[model samples]
Target: MHVLILGGTTEGRLLAGLLDGTVRVTSSLAGRVAAPRLPAGEVRIGGFGGPEGLAAWVRRHDVDAVIDATHPFAERISFNAARAAATAHVPLLVLRRPGWVPVAGDRWHEVGSLEEAAAALDGLGDRVFLTSGRLGLAAFADRPEWFLVRSVDAPDAPMPARSELLLDRGPFTLDGERGLLARHRIDVLVTKDSGGAATAPKLTAAREAAVPVVVVRRPPVPQGVPVASTPEEAAAWARALAG
Candidate 1:
């Protein structure tokens, strides 16, 4: 059985590693990331040229099944993958980690998109800690009075009016994030609902500091697709389907 994994998240890598050698697995990565920790399997970087290209690849590669283990905010790719898989008549599975739930004292202001979050930032705070990734920075480009943008890689394009970019990886501690927040005097936090332990410390720090957060809610999942919460579950499902 041949399997293609639309991957970039930790869960995707873990799933690919688990399925290594058991099936002919190929992991597809969006090349936007710099220095990505790749999985143990055949790796293909960059986009598949949208739904048509992806469908063609599926047919050409003889992909029997596809596992979408991308980030929850990656809705476009997820939709394209679903369309492509359907076109190619291959089974599809989505591995999405559960979203973060607001705890007590968490000053959460959920928004549908980054533009809404940008509009909400007018009276909220002066200094902002943006963790909404690189692709959507244009939404805040015009409103960038001040911002401290953090990303795994420097944005491919230019940023907003006045902004400082911090190129780093996370799994940051609450104490560290709190210290940074204090030093920067950040009053507002902006992030996507990328629920995981690695980047979750910022939310805790924001809650402790009473800083209001503008969280971009996860994009809606494609209708009628099988979903799994963990790499193991996705792998098991793929194996069963292959059998």
Candidate 2:
């Protein structure tokens, strides 16, 4: 009953805790984050090469089932997991949290992709609070707006010409969110619809302050895989496979 989780998220860590003692669990992280919080059980860091390499690993390691519990915006790995699981002839489940939805009085401008979000920012505001991850800063590089870019790691070049980096991680507080918005005088916010409460306070603060938001929509999971919306539900799926 060995289960391999393609995980680097909060739900993935929680799922490892839920199944730690009951079965043989192994969590795989992408190693993008410098100091990622580890889950219980065996852990492997770095890529599995590609889908073919991942399928080979499954065969070599005798993994019984595969669970994809990656970040919502992690498009490449999700598709790779789907292909690897199918090739390995194992049960696969996609543990994806739901995307964020705008509430009443929220000025949300939703876009299909990062490029579109970047384009939408032109009409939104000049002082931008961009929380759309470090790697994506290139999309906003050519825009004239001043950006307050936040990430756990400092972003590489090709970012906005007038951007200041704010290095931080989250589970951010509402008070802090309010303070950041006020101190920076941010009139527009740009983020991905990476759902969950860890960094959701910014959206709340944006709504209260009457700031416009440009949200990049999350990419879809593979078409045929079964999807679970929570760690508990994903754990149930694993338990059924174990039984």
Candidate 3:
């Protein structure tokens, strides 16, 4: 049995590792990062064109099932996968990590888009920790506040005029996150609702520091794909389909 894992997230990597020996898994990455942490098994980098291209690849490779395990905010790829799976007549499963919910003492301002997040930041603070990744920095370009934009890779142009770029990856620790907020004197945080334990310590630090957070809500996933919240559940569904 063969499966194509549209992978890049930690969950995708975990699922691929789990199914490596038991099932034939081909993990595909978008190659946005300079050096991504690769999943075990057959891995391919770069785009598969679009939906039509992905469908062709599925047919050519005889893929039995597909798991759309890309990042939650990666709406374009998720939509393409949905279309490609339907065109190829392959069962598709979407594995999305659940979004974070605000708890007691958590000052979270949820917005629909990056532009809205930028709006939400107005008068919030001058020193901002923008952890919303590298793609949407253009929205904050004209803002008067200073920003500390952090991402896995250095971002492209149209970033904030008064911001500093920090290249890093997570599983960030609570102590480390708190230290950054303190050292940078960050009064506000801008981030996406990219829920996972890996980068969640920042949220905790913000809560502890009483810093307001502007969270850009994740874009809706393409409908009609069966969804799973965990890699274990996704693997189970794939196993059933592959069988």
For residue 165, give model 3's deviation from the true position in Å. Answer: 1.4
Model 2, residue pairs in steric clash: none
Two-way lDDT contest, 2 vs 3, winner: 2
| lDDT scores in order | 0.92, 0.94, 0.94
RMSD of each: 1.3, 0.7, 0.8
Candidate 2 lDDT, 1-243, residue by residue in tens: 999999999999999999999999999999999999999999999999999999999999999999999999899999998999999999899999888889998999999988999889877789999999889788888999999999998788988999899999999999999999999999999999999999999999999999999988899999999999999999999999899
Higher-TM-score candidate of 1 and 2:
2
Query: Residue 238: error of model 2 in Å?
Result: 0.5
Global CA lDDT computed for model 1: 0.92
Specify the highest-lDDT model's number: 2
Q: 1 or 3, which is superior by TM-score?
A: 3
- Once fitted onto the true fold, the runs of candidate 3 whose alpha carbons sit more than 4 angstroms away are none
Candidate 2: worst-modelled 10 consecutive residues by lDDT: 117-126
Clashing pairs in 3: none
Arrange candidates, best lDDT first: 2, 3, 1
lDDT tens digits by residue: candidate 1, 16-83: 99999899899999987878999989999999999999999999999999999999988999999999
lDDT tens digits, residue span 7-121, model 3: 9999999999989999999999999988999999999999999999999999999999999999999999999999999999998999999999999999999999999999898
